[model samples]
Target: MAHTVTDRKKLLNRVKRIKGQSIALENTLENEPDCMAVLQQVAAIKGAVNGLMKEVLEGHLREHLGAEDLSKDQRLEEVEQVISILKSYLK
Candidate 1:
């Protein structure tokens, strides 16, 4: 599937932000920052990672699972995968 340049750029931007967040987290640990502040940063990083995953998953569903020629079994498998992903994230 062909992704627009804009979409690619957006994903790259998100990844870069996540990388920066990771570096900050490392620095915070090295500097012995406040525990609560570090925890909050970690939570924000997790949320950003999850948001990025959701965007990719939604794109996959729209491009592959939504294909008109997909068989019932294929669609069901995709749905199951998505459900499993959600369950794993919840845990």
Candidate 2:
């Protein structure tokens, strides 16, 4: 929750931008229906989503993986979990 509070505006902004891009893509599809334009919009939306993923992942790393009081084994477990998530996400 601390990370969410600290990055509230940032996260909101990213979501808002993604929303805007989605709407724009929808409008373009309805109005122009150009393949290249649609491709560009899709790419932009994917990039925005990836960026948001990165920010959240970093926050998780800072808040959980970087915790100072966790035992070494616990930290390693958390790291492995994070890695598993990343692998699944990238696929």
Candidate 3:
């Protein structure tokens, strides 16, 4: 969220592009008869989503958990939260 204040426009643009890709995937699923075409669209959408996730997660780490000026206690708490998130996400 800290990075979002500065990077809102860029982040929103990425989300919009991902949304467009998802819509295209839906359309292809409904109209395209070819199995390969649907699979390609699905792959593209998945990649876009993964890219967005990577960007946001890195920004969060840099902005919050990785901030050098924070007290050790605060940093440890934030690190635990990030670790919890990763644990669930990877599961």
What is the RMSD, in Å, between candidate 3 and the native fold over all Cα? 1.6
lDDT of 3: 0.84
Best-fitting candidate, scored by TM-score:
2
**What C-alpha lDDT values do all the predictions have?**
0.86, 0.94, 0.84
Could you give the candidate ranking by lDDT, starting with the highest?
2, 1, 3
Model 1 has an lDDT value of 0.86
lDDT of 1 at 52: 90
Best by lDDT: 2
Which 10 residues in a row give candidate 3 its minimum summed lDDT? 24-33
Of 2 and 3, the candidate ranking higher by lDDT: 2
lDDT of 2 by residue, 1-91 (tens): 5897899999999999999999999999889599999999999999999999999999989998888999999999999999999899989
Candidate 3 colliding pairs: none
Error of 2 at 16 (Å): 0.9
Candidate numbers sorted by TM-score from highest down: 2, 3, 1
Question: What TM-score does prediction 1 earn?
Answer: 0.81
Candidate 2, residue 49: Cα displacement in angstroms equals: 1.0
TM-score for candidate 3, residues paired by index = 0.84
